[model samples]
Target chain A: MAAGDSGEDKLIARLFGSVATHPGALGLKDDAALLAVPPGHELVLTKDALVAGVHFFPDDPPASIARKAMRVNLSDLAAKGADPLGVLLAFAIPPDMDAAALEAFAGGIGADATLYGAPLLGGDTVRTPGPFTVSITALGAVPTGQMVRRATARPGEAIVVSGTIGDSALGLALRLDPARSGFAGLDSASLDHLRDRYLHPRPRLALARPLRGRASAAMDVSDGLVGDLRKLLSASGVAGTIEASRVPFSAAARAAIAAEPALLETALTGGDDYEILAVMPDHEVSAFSTFATAAGIGVSVIGHTHEGEGLSVRDGDGAELTLARGSFSHF
Target chain B: MAAGDSGEDKLIARLFGSVATHPGALGLKDDAALLAVPPGHELVLTKDALVAGVHFFPDDPPASIARKAMRVNLSDLAAKGADPLGVLLAFAIPPDMDAAALEAFAGGIGADATLYGAPLLGGDTVRTPGPFTVSITALGAVPTGQMVRRATARPGEAIVVSGTIGDSALGLALRLDPARSGFAGLDSASLDHLRDRYLHPRPRLALARPLRGRASAAMDVSDGLVGDLRKLLSASGVAGTIEASRVPFSAAARAAIAAEPALLETALTGGDDYEILAVMPDHEVSAFSTFATAAGIGVSVIGHTHEGEGLSVRDGDGAELTLARGSFSHF
Candidate 1:
């Protein structure tokens, strides 16, 4: 009940007020914001939270942490085929955090808010006796009844994925232990590629229009492609078959797997890719791919849906591949 | 990017899914939710964060914590003269929080969501190595361009407040030290009254419509009456005078103040009283009061606005009173 004092108020206004460009934000001075949902559109809502030592390294750059938090929520909106509206941030600042770090964090959010057209609407900031944490709730808009759903995929649809997968997982591995075995073969560029993928996510917002027009079901791959696909299949009450060879990977990821064959499982099941996994009619694959190409996004058909209740992965030799773990879970 | 594991997913579904009754929630099976804004209405958005050990007692009942968290955000919406639409929760669970406590917390949210007509739409949950925290983003709807603002109070307007003040601050003091000298004369019923007021906040949602129609400016009294009134005055570029004797107080608060005259300052400056403070033309006060009475909420005219630059509080004999601190500030 002890609300924000002048110190907290001044901190928020100085740090975040500039990004709240939407008039509805009331210049971060009001108790709430007003958003006019575009006519004939429905609002899409999603929230994601990141904590130090869990989602990212405690010493990671403040800008990177802010960008990751905003991107993760934006990725959900993209998967739902919704255009960005705005975002609300709930920030918990550890006592030891410095003013410079907070300024950098706010700068990162402002940068992304501009890049993605998701203006900073309003937010709350509080002191915490724990690690620094950020929780973002992103608002989006989609034409009425046009939001792509995870439960609408039917049997015999082609399963499509946008952008390369597994890079982030390998990047995470390199981040965890850069000198680990098999990584000795990687060149500096390849190592940087893997690491950058882990540090920053590219939310496939450009694919929203195409997905809304043609996709039967869709969701972003945050918890690994295989596990997330399983979730999608479960939601749709169907089964899926993924061709391992068809799963697109960046050159860096391919090099990492080539050096360490055991790392293939990590690449396939590791999370944080933030790519869109979508389902559409088999006949519409070409059209969807064309749209993706026009938008400068890479699209790959990795598998297909069928009338079953689980997922199967097949290797190049037509042999089934088994993963040590389906996906990374923060249990 | 290390997404939620099966344990986290199952925990969220089992503990919080039942309350996501909005059709747009898709039974909490999707990554995001879809909400259709009623025609001719705009969305009102607000977010608030509560951290364990800072915002509330860590050992408080799980249900009480949940209700307080939810009500604080809803209170913001009510102040905007909007009706509840839905909410998204971002929860970071401490390592030691138990499942039974989580269930009770979710139960509390469900009860309030039902009572206030703000169903849970979607949310995210993650394990944290920090204190338990809940960040809620509440959505509401108001007729386009009709949201009451904190920056529109004009000169000569009547400053009215709903319900009593200082009860929560007194309650918090009693809670912190039940055997404090000044509270020794308080009966058990009075003590409970103060404690319950601190634990639960009535949002005054029923007055939204009346405020939208009549109030020139409005905001909730969360950070004490004097400080919050200063904010409202500052935002509107005006000043005001308050009659100290006219400020409403609950029977328990009155008793506490009578027992210890010094406690009056604590009541005036103590935060956590979530009543509505509204401004309106002097002639409209009677109609506004009638509307509030019909809605079963108390209304008190305690002050008047004028073309000035600061706030002044006068005693019964017109002597100005000075406060050591204007409000409760966390920092």
Candidate 2:
């Protein structure tokens, strides 16, 4: 990172200007970006921040860190059933940060912005006392009044989640304490799968259009399924019953859990799963599943909404199970 | 300042839920905010970040810190000729921060959001190891194709500024080293006036409408006027000649400079002056000035754009003045 104001300006123009292809971005020379929302389309706004040593290790790959910053917000947009348009990034780093590292980080951000079709609109970079951090504010658009929300679920609706869960949690476990994770029996490939999931999350953006047209309510599960489901139920003034056995888990996660039964709790309440959780009428389940499967993403029916209050999870034998904790939190 | 996931959720709901009253905000229960852009309107986006011990004193009132975070972005919207619609905040703070401080910060943010008519749409809060930081992305709306740009200045256009410019810079000097600020001769009220300017910046939002209709180019002077004007001229592919004598200063600022002549450079090149700098056709200057005056804001012609390459500042005698530096730099 550069030390002064002129250096900061020059750094922005040289490192970030190329991504400001949108005309309204004004080539990033203007103070604010101009975004023309198509008629009848409403904008979706979401922001997420990643702090070194908390969100990711300080030595983590710059590309992965950048991708994570963008993906978290992308996950929010996906849950809202909107397509991303652009993003503004704010970076705070120690003044002594390597210039090459900053370049790599920007390159990664630009790469993901291009991949997700969310062009870089503009950004602010500044010096921090310690612990580099990145904050991304992503903008998207959906048809007027069509955004899927968490408070619209109703009784008798089927709760579905896109893609498998628990991998990220297990991945973190392995990354933090490989030997103590009790995954020694797992094959190397399984360990790699868990680790990779922790590094990058695939937001269910492809399901946005389908969910927007049919789902009653939706949100991205970032803070563990049980806790997030409870939040969703509370917001909708409803309750839910989730089948523990039906909660999708990747083969790697299944093996790791099989090696240690206590891992189930971690799978249940250890967040960082960037997958879409949606509620829809039971009648639309089959069609939605088919469409989702055809698109190469799994859509599993794991629960149902009810008129009561909180959330409960049932075991394979249909007996309600208790959890040690509800969700992953950073306070 | 909660300690875990559930705690974080509770904190957000308890402190911020009421402010997310916009229907599109979905009561702060959704993954992203939905904004229905009125027909024929475009969104203006800008993001600014403030770091503890960098942007402001870490001991500054939490409310002032929060207000500064939002006001800096509001200043950007003002320069863009847009009316703020909403704001999204991202906060990364030390986990051990006092709960009372967080409450005060939130209250301050809420107050400013209300005062600026930019409601809080959504925000993300997370834990940082050290150095608390706040990043605000403010969204605004302007009639389609009406956003003012910094690259639109043409030769022969008159350069204008809304409000006095040097108070903030001088105020910062006094705050940093009170005894050396050369303010001992000033009355207590004048000292307070300078200090207050440093703490709170009044963004020129009211000038947006008139500037949109008439200004050839516009930008907010966050950096010093000399550097910012150079940037504007560079972006517009034009040059300018500024009359230093015409640069406006507050009475307190003039008094301080009279006591220490060298403080003039600090007033000219030191940044943090959140005033609006604009260019307009000579013919529109009178009308624009009349409208600005009626709005109770001062508008002064300090320069003129020309078909050249760089900026030059001249005194009342037509002799060029030398500057130690063009602008305040953070590098």
Candidate 3:
């Protein structure tokens, strides 16, 4: 019943009200907010920016834009096994961004932060003349020494992946041309599922804890398999091969891409996968799969590391299938 | 040079560098960077934005703009006894903004941050179609129970202000219309000093620790004396009055304003003072002043908080002089 209970002020209260912290916060009445770190958790900090047309579809719905903004940052934290603590968002909007759009974007941000048990810490807002931009600086806390690194892969380690790899890329292609998905029996529900997954990625923070001791040199597949895996391998000073027959693909994706041989390479090299990719020692592979199954997440053995420094994938006839090593670059 | 020396490669290095102890941060080679917090210090976070026309003059030099951006945020942190730790800059530029201007702006930011001992953390850059905008989110730390709050002022507390007041607004007015300057004696050096101070404020962060136990309540003066002090009184549920004879003014300010009576009132109430206003118990006033002087900062006793709920300033013989509280109002 206060006069300030509408618009940005209201949105701010709703976004940050759930943050439970030490008594030192003073309930957010000042220019800045305060937070205390408990003894057990180490803080994790990361920042990312999503520019209009640069990071996402410029015409994407506001909610989707908001979701992408938070999700990508969350994905980074997930790869580290850091649970979401809170986020600081600095948003610059063009005057063309209407009031309804702004409100919806804020709503989406609040929803995701609450869903992940993360609170909104603080942020800045400004108006620009050009396109919309959202920058989120995330903070999380994890127990010390449990984080996975991308530079620890060993030779002979089995390359493992979480969920499916090709779905997001396939979904993106379909979304770009919604009319004929080219899959004979594709249903609306399946299309929607893929679209949702592609639009909003689920960070594998859950697997971060379980993968700590077993998986060496882990990272999320943002860029497609072949591309991101190359970086992972280069970091670890190792490389490996995958079987073309084993590149996981949904039925719809397979049907759509079967006639276009280049599609396989595209799907393998495209970015935005947001799935976990790691190297597990052969002896620990079984236990790792079991642990993943217990957690109700998918795990697959896709390839293995070799002494050489590049990737190689063979078809069923044992002939090598050439591939590209770079995906979407940030610049 | 090392492999990371190239501009393009430098970005890759920056993204992958510095993974702290937090479990989710395995280094930045993946899609996001990770970090961990150190122990002991409580976090103080503040955010402020500057628009091209609204917050500043359009012709301000790029270095001054950057300096003002950090200064405004620092002023907020100083009010709470917070030591500035780092800053995140989110910039939105108009397409027409020159490349040289932008480079100068960035250089200024680098210089100020380095001088303050707070390095850049991370942020975003984007193109905008509207007014040029700069948003800064700052991080500072203070020990538990050491920060000040505006709402904690007692009824009998003495009110004090740091540094000279009314100079910036008067200085700005003179700069805006050189021909209209009331003082015929105004010279280049004096005008330059006043102009620089108006453009680039100095936040009193060093005084945070010194004033920790001294002041009961405090805040920065962004909106001139009466305006900002009105805010303090509203927060603390008290009323105050300043003696007109006791109001602080510089010799130059007096000379300039004497030509126009209305101009004097504007200076007294104009906003963006960037000074600290604090309330202390009457007994601690002398000690506070002494402490400030020892630190090489100026101080003045302006007013006192009484049990009432309004603000006023009285001339000699208790005659009230009605004036607008300093600064412009958005609405």
Candidate 4:
């Protein structure tokens, strides 16, 4: 390393590895990161690219951007009950980005990698135009027949979710257009939580291990719970009924929702929740809270699966709310 | 199953299984794409992004750009002698690009993927500014004990190249900045070959299987031969000697080189070659050619490995020639 070399590379080098790592990665110093799967286990490999404007705000803080990129990938691994082995990051840095910003970005990536216990193996970095992008390809391992999929939810399954939903979308509302209600009157602590959810949402990797063969249809709530749950139901070939009142919301979230009635709609439709939604057999419903508690996470009974056609929200009186569907429509 | 509907859930239907395809990817309807990996063999992945103006000229044909992106990734897979299973492409199209051009780009990707027997598994798309960046991550499989590494080259091994060197860089020079003497009066056929070499060089996937149990040190020649070979030498902790007269150049390339003595230097030092460079004991030389021939590829020798530090090139008389050490230094 030269005294006046590019500082970002040096910082990235300092952060690419966690505790123990593959010996080959240490020696190769090449761009292709290498991971050795454990014996008797299969690997689940996933890749995701976060573009500057499309995925995140153009002026998003580099630290938050880095954390979000890693977190989104972790969300995928979490959905499958997969153990983190390592990851490869392919980044395109704009020419204008200074070495300091790049250093911070790399530091954030290192921090998240360390948090998730996933090593940063190897990657290639190149220069690009104004709106840059970061693509992370995460590799994980799971014992054969233990990984979860989004297609096995039985018709009479119980729909469940970990953590509160809509905070991330609410946070985006504040960041992009402050005129949107609910977020404007948020308390300091609530404000902080919202930002964290938007910028560095935690992936439920720890919960994945225990949910191994238990959860039926499972996936992370990326595009808001209602929206994501609809897709889950669709994939499972079952319809779902999520009680709007039974939906769990933080105390602060409830207060915010009260301030802006429109906030409920945003929370239901706005994307980027990143919580995990799983469908389990009706008997599994009684065990949901206990399982989540044992895993040191919270679980909420968000809905019920039925052998019907479309997603429906209901009230205490068991009357359908008349809303058409659950979440974001890509079309 | 709807009336005349293609069943494609628009972009959302394509999101899942976009990377690390699940075996039952097709089952995740109306939302995510699903394609699964087979058991036993783990995945070896590599990604590279090419920006339009930064990577190729703005006027460069979109199909060529698309092919080049896939080629670059395939070259990486070839370096490991891994079998091409599938690929994930993350392409950023400039908003100003013509719709036909974008279609051509996608067609080019589909065409090449089919050509190499590697299908397009999944990917994400977005809009970017002028320099259109195309990022591709290629996945391949190698037997547990067969994948080659760059760190295994030993001292006293012969440094050999799979094909003639310096053509691509010379070809690049002709396409970009055509005022050079070698291309100033070139015909379209000559220019087209040069452009194709620069634009869509083939990745030697077929050689991967045979090279797996062989090739002490190996890597694709993305940079010019001298420079890339230097990487192999450095990674292997050895040095090399280049037989300049033995360096195979195309007929037109030689004629072009004759027009300007410096053209040889460009060919020698320029990159984007996409060939393979390996180090092996003298005895394995014949086997490589035979293997390559059977695989329907080309191979040639241009150098020998030495005991010490830097690269040395010799002319027909076997005396060192005065030229730059390597091509495309990391500026």
Whose TM-score is higher: candidate 1's or candidate 2's? 1
For residues B1-331, write the lDDT of model 2, one tens digit per residue. 1124455547766777766666766666678888888789889999998898888888889889999999999998999899999999889868667778888888988898889888888868887887889999999999998999988888998989988878888888888788974787888888998888888988888888888979888999888888888888988999999998899988998899989988888888878888889999999989888888898999989989989889989987989989989888642
**Candidates 2 and 3, the one with greater DockQ:** 2
In the predicted model 1, the residue pairs found to clash are none
lDDT score, candidate 2, position B268? 80
DockQ for every model comes to: 0.91, 0.85, 0.43, 0.35
Task: State the weakest 10-residue window (summed lDDT) of model 2 chain B.
Answer: B1-10
**Between the candidate structures 2 and 4, which one is better when assessed by lDDT?**
2
| Candidate 3: true contacts recovered, fraction | 0.53
Residues A183-249, model 2: lDDT tens digits:
9888999898898888888877888888887999999989888888887888799989999999999
* TM-score between candidate 2 and the true structure: 0.97
User: Tens digit of lDDT per residue, candidate 3, span A103-205?
Assistant: 7787777788777766666666655555677877676666766566677789998988887777777677667766653543567776776677777887776
Quantify all predictions' global Cα lDDT against the true fold: 0.89, 0.85, 0.70, 0.70
Relative to the unseen true structure, what is the C-alpha lDDT of residue A111 in candidate 1, on a scale of 0 to 100? Answer: 95
Give the poorly placed runs of model 4, Cα more than 4 Å off.
A1-21, A24-28, A178-181, A316-319, A322-331, B1-42, B97-99, B322-325, B329-331
* Candidate achieving higher TM-score, 2 or 3: 2
Candidate 3: C-alpha lDDT: 0.70
True-vs-predicted CA distance for residue A80, candidate 4, Å: 2.5
Better of 2 and 4 by TM-score: 2
